[model samples]
Target: MNAPASAIEQLQLGLPELDWITDPNRIQRLSQDFSWFSPVLTRQLEGKVADAVVRPRTEEQIRQVVAACARLKLPLTLRGSGTGNYGQTTPLAGGVVLDMTSFNELLWLRPGLARAQAGIRLNEIEKAAQAEGQELRCMPSTYRSATLGGLFGGGFGGVGSINYGPLAAPGNVVGLKAMTIEPEPQIIELRGAEAMRMHHLWGTNGLVLELEIGLAPAQPWLETLAVFDDFDAALAFADQLARAPGLDKREVAFLASPVPDYLTQLAESLPKGCHAVLSLVAEAGEEALAELVSAHGGRVSYRRTAAEVSKSHKTLMEYTWNHTTLHALRVDKSLTYLQTTFTPGEYVRQITELSRRYAGEVFMHAEFLRNMEGQTNCSALQIVRFTTEERLQQIIDEHRAYGVRINNPHTFIVEDGKAGGDLPEDVLAMKARFDPLGLLNPGKLRGWPVGAAS
Candidate 1:
C-alpha cells in the first residue's frame, strides 16, 4: 500500500538538505505524464502513483538520492518535463520519484558538440548552441518544454531527423553520463555506440546526469505549408522536396484532408477538402521548394521564416508527429495513433495498401525521414478513430500481416517489438550492472526481474 519503509524513513531522516514533496496533491501531479494520450495506457495507469517525490538540485544530491534508494530497496522513477506521450514516467510500482527538472545547467558548448545537465530544456540547449553558430541535430515536437535528457531517453527523432537520423543513429548523441543505483552510486560514462544502451530506455536502466551531443550548423529554417486538391500530388511534392539536392529539409509531413481540418490554429491556411504538406525547409531553398510545389500541382499556402514564427509562436513542427494526435484529440477525444515505419522501396506501397483498407477510420499522417542507412524513407504517426480495443488490435494484426511494422503507442515498454523486435539484451545487461535491484522504474518494463526481459 505504501513505499518501502526503510526508503521513506532514510530519505526523510537522512536527507534534510533535499527538497522532498510529501503533499499528495503535488506528488499525484508529478507522478503523471501524457499517458492519457493513449486510452489503453490511461485505463491501466489512471490511479497509479509514486509514494513521494524528491528533487535533487545537483549531481551530488542525485547520487545521494540514488544511494539511499538503493540501500533501502526503493523503486526510483526519473522524470523530466513530463511532456512524454507514453507512460514513460508513470510509477506503476510506488516508490520515490527523482524529479530531474531542477538539475538544469549548461555544462559546456563547442562548435560541433554541446554538453549539459540532463534536466535542461531542449529549447535552451538549441538556443545556447545557436548562439555558438551550431544547433541540435534533432529535437522533439515538444521542444519548448521537453528536457533534452527526457527527449533523448524517451524520444527517437523529430524535425531534424530528416537530415540527421534518429537519436541512436551514428553520432547524434556522442556522450552520456549516468548514475547507477547503489549504496555508493557509481558513475557510468558512455561514449560512441555504447551510449545506445540508454538512448531511449525511458530511464529504466541508468539515471542520466549529463549529455554531450553532436551539433550541426544552425540553419535559417522556414516553416511552410503546401495545400493540394489531390492527396497523391501532395505526397509526390513532399517526396520530391525531401530528395531535392541543395534543399535543406527538416520536416516533410503529409496530412490528409480532415487531418488539417482538425488543426484549429491553421484552419484558415489549409483549404477545405484539400490535403497538406507541412515542411521546415532552409530559407535558401524556398524558391526551389515553391517551384517544386507548383510543378506537383499544389500551392504553397503558408510560409514564415523561423524568426517570424518565433515572434508569432506558431510552429509547423507541432502539426507533425505525435503532436498531430494531440491536436486531433482536442477536436475528437475518441482518437489514437500508431507509430508505423515504411522502409525504403516498399513504403509507398505499404502506406497505399493500409490507406486503401482503413480509409477514413485511420487517416494517414506521414513524416518523411532518412533512415540510419541514409535511405529516404518515412514513418507514420497516423491518427486513428478509436472504436474498440479489439478493433485496434485487429488493425495492428492486419498491418503485421502485410509486413507493415507498427509500434503500439498504447503500451509503455522499452521492448515494443517495433525497432529491434527481439529483446534488448545490451540494455537489460546494463540495467543489471547499474541497478542490480532492478529498482529503477520497475513496472514500466514488463520484462522485470531481468529474466522476463530476455
Candidate 2:
C-alpha cells in the first residue's frame, strides 16, 4: 500500500524545518531514472512517481527526514544522481523520494584512500583523489554525475574492474557510515566486509550517509581505438589486452560491427562497418598495444594522449558500457539491450559463436574485466532489436541454454535482477536490523515484504 495521505501530511509537518518539495512536475522527474532504456521497464513503471520529495543538506537533516518517515511509516525511496538504468530510484509505492544530491561533500582524501558524503559525485571524488596522485579504482561510465552512494547501492564495477575486479571485491571499499531507520535514528559505522552488507541492494537495506573508498595510484592513460574488418580478430585483440599483465591498462571494450555505427559522435574514428576495440592504456604500454593491434590485423584509427583527452574533455570511456545502449537508442527507438556474462576461460569463443548465431539481431558490445573471483572474462551489454516481450524472454532463455549468465535488468526487484532468485540470509538479517519497519525502498527487496517485521 502507498503511504496514507494523512501520514504524508504528518511527515511534512514533522519535518517543516527541512527542504520538502511537493511540486508535481519536479516530483515526477525526481522519481524517474534511466529505466526507459528497457522497453519492458518503461511500460512496467510508466506512471510510478513519488508523492513528494525531500532534499536533506546535512547528516542531521537526513536524520530528521528518516526519523519522521519512520515514525509515519512512510515508504521512503533513496535517490542519488538517478543515473542508473534499472529503474533503481523509481518508487513502486508512492511516498517520498529522498534526494541526496545536495548533501554532497568530499570529507577527506589521503594517499590510496578517500572518504566522502554519499551524495558527492564520483567525478568530484576522482578530481580530489587526483590532486593526491590517486584515482578511483572503479567508476561507471556515468561517473560524471553518478553519486558514490548510487554506485555502492545499485552498480557493478566499471573501467578499473579489469585490475581490481568489481566494487564488491574486497579492498575496493574500505568502510561506510549508515543510519538505521527509526524514530530515533542511530548513526553507525561499519568497516571491512561488514560494510558491504548494504552494497548493491538499491539502498533498501539501510541509509548510507558517507562512504570511505580505496583508491589507486594515478596513471597517465592514453586513449586509443583499434578498428578491424573481422569480428573474431577484434574480440581476440581485446581479450589479449585484458590478459596482458605487462600492459598497464584501465579499459578494454569490444564493439562488434554495426554497433560502432551507432556512435555517431565518434564517426571520424569509427569507420563504417568496422568492429572496434577501445582502450585506455598507460603511455608506457603504447608500443605493446600497437603490436597487438597489428598482430590482429586491426589498425589504430584514433589516438588521444592523456593530456589531449583532458583538454578535449572527451574520452572513449563514455562510448563503452551502458552509454553504448544510450547511443543505440538515440539511433533506433525500438532497440533494447541485455546484460550477459560469458564463461571465464571460454568467453572469447562464446562471444564469437553468439555473434555468429545472432548476427544482425543482437549486435555485440562487450567490456572485458576480471570477475569477483579474479577470473578474466568479457561481460556483454549487447544491443537487441526489439520485437516483443516473448522474443526477449526467448533470447534470454537461449543464452542460458548456451551457459551464459544473464543478469536481467528489466526487473526492479532486488532478487529478480540478480542471476540468483533470492537474497542471502545475512543480507535479509541486515535489512531486518537496519530497517525494521521496511520503510526504506520498500517494494524493491523481494526477500523482505514492505512493512514486515524482522
Candidate 3:
C-alpha cells in the first residue's frame, strides 16, 4: 500500500478532472461509518487511512477513474450516502474512496417502474413517484439519506418490506446498469435473475450506475402511534395485526423500549411499565383499521389522515429505526445492532427471554418484516446497547450459541441468508469473468476470486 499523501498526489496527477480529497481530517471522517464494530477505528488507531478519496459526477468519469486505478493496481471502494450500518462501504485496502453521491439523476418513470442514477436518494425518487400517483414498493429506514445504490448494495429489510417483500426479490427490481473492471472496463445492463444476483453484495461484484424498480400505486395511508401496558401484549397485537389478511399494506411495525427520550412521550401516555409500537398502514380506511386495532386490544393513541401522512411521511423518516438508533447511541456509545430472521409465531417468547438475559446491559428494539414463502417466517431487526465492547461481543456470542442467525451490521455486511448462499459462487465467477484484476472492492465480497487481490 502507498502512503496516503503520495497516493493522493499520484491520483490527482492521473485524473486531474476528478475531484480529490487529501486532507487528513476529511479522510478520517470518510474512513468510518455508523457501524459500531467497524475496523476503521482500529485501522485509524494504527495510523492508516484511505490513500485518497475521489468524487466523480459522470458515468464516463467513474469509468475513467476505475480504469486508471486498475492500471495502477490500486484498490477502489464505492460509497453512497454512508448511512449503511455495516462496514460494507469502508475501504479495507486503504486505496481510493469513490463517492458516488454526485451521480444523482432520475432517468425515467413510467406507470409501474422508474429508473434512477445510483446516487439518487429513496425519498427523492418517492416524491417523483408520488407526482405520478405511485410510490416505491419498499425502502429501508434510512431512505432520506440513503442512496439507491447503497440500499441495493447493502440494505436489507425496511418499513415497506412487510408488504412488498425484501428488495432482492425478482419482482422488486426490474433492471440495472453496472460498470465492470476487468481485462477492459465496460458498462453492462442486466435484468431478471442476472440483475437480481447483485443485490446486497456490498458493491463487490460491480459498481451500479442506474437502477429500474417496480412501483406501487400511491394510496391514502393512516399513520398511528400506539402504546401498551405490557411488552407481551404489544408483541401479540403486533403479530396479529401483521398476520391479519387484507392488511398487506402496513408500512412499518416498529417497537421500542422506554429508554429513549422520544419514547418518553409514549411512556407518559401509557400506564406504568408500558412499551410502544408505531404502525403505519396504507390503502386502508380509518374505520376498518380502527376496528382491527380494537379487536386486538390496541388503542389508537394518535392518528394522522392520509393527506397529513403524505405531506409528513418524508419527515417521519427521522423517527424511524435508523434515527431511533442514533438517538439511543447518545446514551451508550458502544451500542451495536443485529439483523435476524425469526418465525413471528415464536418471536415474542424468544425476544422476551433474550431481553431478560441481557437485562440492563442490552435493550431490545425490533422491526417486523414481511413473511416469506408463506412459511410463517418473518424477519426482525434488533439493536443491542452495551456499555463496553466486551459486553457487545458477549451478547453477539450468546445470540449465536442459541442457534439465532445474525447478520451483524456492526462488523460484517447484513444480507438475506437465502441470497448469501448463492452470492459467493456467482460473485466470484462474475469477478473472474469481468473484474479479473479484482480492482473493484477487492476484499469486500465474501468469496471474491481467490488470489485476485492486487
Model 1 CA lDDT for position 76? 88
lDDT of 2 by residue, 285-389 (tens): 999999999999999999999999899999888987998899989999999999999889999889988989998899999999999899998899999999999
Model 1 off-target regions past 4 Å? Answer: 1-6, 417-422, 449-454
In candidate 3, residue 20 scores what lDDT?
A: 85
Q: After superposition, how far is residue 127 of candidate 3 from its true place, in Å?
A: 0.5
Error of 1 at 308 (Å): 1.2
Candidate 2 TM-score, C-alpha based: 0.97
Local error of candidate 2 at residue 396 (angstroms): 0.8
lDDT scores for all predictions? 0.85, 0.91, 0.69
Maximum-TM-score candidate: 2
Q: Candidate 2: deviation at residue 306, Å? A: 0.7
Which tens-of-lDDT digit does each residue in 255-305 have in candidate 3? 646533434333444454456666677645566667766766667777776
Q: What is the descending TM-score order?
A: 2, 1, 3
- Where model 2 places Cα greater than 4 Å from the true spot, the runs are 1-5, 450-454
lDDT of 3: 0.69
Clashing pairs in 3: 162-370
Is 2 or 3 the stronger prediction by lDDT?
2
lDDT of 2 at 312: 91
Cα lDDT for residue 254, candidate 2:
96
Residue ranges of candidate 3 with Cα displaced over 4 Å: 1-8, 37-48, 254-256, 259-273, 310-317, 374-377, 387-390, 413-423, 446-452
Candidate 1, residue 304: the lDDT equals: 96
